[model samples]
Target: MYETFGAVVQGPRVEFHLFLPDNARDPSQYFRGGSPRIKQIHVRGDFQDAVGSQNWSLDQTFKMQRLEHPHGWLYKLAIEQDLNDGYYQYKYFVEFENGTQRWVSDPIAKYGGNDQNENSAFVIGGRHTVVHPIARRRPPRDLVIYETHLDDFTAAFRHDKTPVDAFRERLDYLQELGVNAIEFMPWTAWPGSGFSWGYDPVAFFSVENRYVDDPAKPADKLVKLMELINDLHERGMQVIMDGVFNHVRAGNDPNLGFPYRWLYQVPSDSPFIGAFAGGGFFEEFDYQNNCVAEFIRDVCLYWLDRFQLDGIRFDYTLGFFRQGDAGVGIAKLIADLHQSLNQTGRSNVALFIEHLTDNRFEAIRDTNDIGAAGCWFDPFMFKHFEYCRNGNIDSGILRILNANLDFAPGKEPVTYLENHDHSSIMQEAGGRGRWFKTQPAAIALMTAPGAVMLHHGQEFGQEEWLPGSGDGRVVPRPLRWEESPLGGDAIGTRLFGLYQRLIAIRQRHPALRSPNFFPFPFNHPEGYGAFPEQDVVIYHRWGQAEDGGFERFIIVVNYSDFDQRIDIPFATDGHWEDLLNGGVVFVDNQKLRRQKINSNWGRIYYRKA
Candidate 1:
């Protein structure tokens, strides 16, 4: 039925390898053949042969060669043309001499595809998926990220709606809030009793069918998901999916086998270490093996190539890397993947890791040197929660902040006040009462440092927790629509307004986005105001404004609550306008503004002059 290419006969169990065809320029040239174009490229082989056709426009025309050899044969791809600059998805079909055609996946992907029973490979050309300079060029320092489950976010805006309609309804709402990016809990399909966080997915390559138009066809579902992504892009929204590679769903997984038992790691000598949230211990991938590494790499490439996704948030870093000599370390895994992605010539995508371990800052920091864009910092949440819940500063805050200061500006960490996992916990702790005292801490979370993320429903002050483990006991996670009866009024409105104004201000000013601190002397151990003690964090952004105007602005947040005058020092001596308030302040003479400040609400002074 499909266009026919030649086929190579091969034995069923022989090991075969395929690579991107290389061409040599001269004697000095070490390559083999020219690269292949999807419209023109073709391959036929022994066990399996796949091609990275690079044909993006058509669905079926993009499908390239499929070959199989009954004897022993290997396949190599030669692409004589280039597809210019764009994203591409590729799969291989193997037709045996016995007249049986099969789909073979790319063994090189970080994570494999769901459509192919075997493995479908993927790669990005001259680009890797990264948050663009425009998207985060001027990120809001003070962010009130509303962490919403993708399903819940859609469901909240709909009545008797299908998944397609639900996703379509929330696009404008998400854009209206001016969230820099929306972090969706994993959308990959997984079998569940009902609803799931989507952490235990067997089909990493496919979007969850629950949200698709057909909800039955994998190919059709994938196309629908892509359409949703295109719509989001049209609206100028970046999408980040929570990736759970640490575990897999049993029975449903075909790679591991039906009624799958190899998905979990159990010691031969003892019992299970702990039960995984998705009903399995963990599907441990042997990272040391080249095959395993290739599989993971392909998975990462698939999403970037297929959907043009902005970024990926690795759910649990601890589980990915095993704990021994033979085992691969997280640093190595991240570095290798980063290097491979860098080949695509795209801006470095934000690679954020969830380092929940208190003392593992070093381990996480090393990821940067290995080419990671950044990491998720929990210290922001802990300090804020400690102050909110216990009404006191914890020693842990100062220690972690000081240690984290080692990182250069704009590359420190991904900071957030609450997420789906933690919010659920906070809600349960409140019992009949409020989990976190409705206060100004939300303001502080947005202004803190690194890349910021807001959990869904946070803007609406949604206080219900989703049913799950991890940190669900403290914060509640549920769909609380912005204007619904279940949502709070004054508190939610105030917080939402604060986030909007702050985000707008940050978007207008660059200095506020990438901050540089200038510590002021403090007498006591505890911080007097919102910031850490003596840390009078300052920032300087060097560049022309978006409108091609020269604008210089400075942000001063006094961490001390009591009236304290600190020397204002800078190279330029001139009159600076306090943008937050319509007042001119002398910066040359260090004219300190003194005032009584509240314990939680810190003072922010911006320069206009």
Candidate 2:
């Protein structure tokens, strides 16, 4: 039987378990000698007050008993009588070989306490946890994603500094953006009780204490998250967590290392900390250890099951992906998740990887081998940027835009022009003044045969010129909603309306979501091909619809400043509705219509079905 680690509330008693596996097959030779030997563990907390002592009194510490497990050894402490009620804060005062001792927080703590000493807390008489069901579920391909950081997103348009106070009300405005999915950046527990991206998570199970309204009552943090997710689901939008499982921040510094890493005498001797790949970004997880894989999988499962998350966007899989090693790492993790999901009858839990390797084909291969919904397709973003900035459009650009060519028969690609990693699309377009150029780019993004994504506020032209420094990501990049269509900036507001219209078109028309992207005009090789000189391209997208008929759409993209008249091929002779601009153009001949498309714009025409 599987048991949960950390503090588990079982009936009237709270049972705490600390996992330290005895690994004979550890890849590290250092594991043999000078390994951490646990002599004793004392539970120090406010509960000691019930035993006639002050809070966190170490006068006579509460000792834990060690027991053998299937994997290795575990330190267990059960508290049923010591709890007199409201809340309790605790930490482990551990003694190792040769009198080497250190204090460490619960590695899998669910809630943090108000202290710089890294304390884990639990509510004694709290009600059982609530698991909210998803209001509406959606498949991966039909998603339009909007990525945002909770702090950056909430910090904007509010002055009182109660970040989540007005958050529920703000969801209505966000729902109007036409995004069916919201991809939030990580909010896991970081080192200090200050601002952080939560990328270097120390406690995988705990939410960042600082993000909550009150650090002492940290369960409110989890409740707020659940409530927010419920709100999004109710609004018909799925939520995707920016899950960072590849590596963790580890060091001797009190404000930098994970509790698990600090528990060992020599941190390097820990099986969970080692070099899995050559990424060298942080303290990477060594998947060679079975316990390490299980621990991370447990962390992932806990969040997904408890929070009722619709999906997870795995951050930086390159840090752990071994060469063709399918047993551990991303492959086994994904396989394990799928098996669990299947057994529970949960469907449409999308898993995407950000293996931004230079070889773009590698993502497709890995996604196929390891079972992921898709990879963040960034090569298209690079090519699209070139076209937007320098008018360097070519046939190769069309090939890249048509993701069907790369991601084959039924595979989906998570395509985006702006994401959390890159600067805003408006910034890449040299400023907000060149907003018109993004019109064609927006059309291409929506009409592309894949899952579309937008960085937060990208719809309303959020611009921030990121520096080359590493601090660029941590810099304040708030959403200027004032620049939106609801705001004052004329140029920024124009792009907002364009995105609204484009998303509506994509949502209503299934042809745009189909896996058919023809580079040639209506698949005619001798017809008007993509002109590199004129910076214009034409393509066709179609899919089989209900009633045994075909739904089709033609997209004419113009990249150059000059308005180009391109021959648009119509399959049927009737009135064609320009979905982007709501203009109707009649077509008598089934051949071609020489249409003059606006500069830095695109035309999407289809029958009103």
Most accurate candidate by lDDT:
2
**Cα TM-score per model:** 0.65, 0.93
After superposition, which runs of candidate 2 have C-alpha atoms over 4 Å from their true positions?
Answer: 1-3, 10-13, 24-35, 82-87, 126-129, 158-166, 215-218, 408-410, 520-523, 526-529, 546-549
Error of 2 at 132 (Å): 2.5
lDDT values, one for every candidate: 0.46, 0.76
Q: Candidate 2, residues 1-609: lDDT per residue as tens digits?
A: 123777777544577888777654333322332245778888888777776667676655467888877656779887656465455678888788769878788887888766676688766664344657676677788899988877778776656534554467678767787899999888787777666666878888887766664544444656766777778887888888888989988867633578767777777667778777768467888776676788888888888888888889999887778758788788889989999889988888888888867788678777777678888888778777787778658777666667755564445789998887777677778788777777778888998888889988788877776665576567666677778766777876677778888998888877788777775323365343477877887777787654547777877888888988777776678878888778888877654556788898888888744
Candidate 1 C-alpha lDDT tens digits along 139-173: 22323234456566766555555465467776766
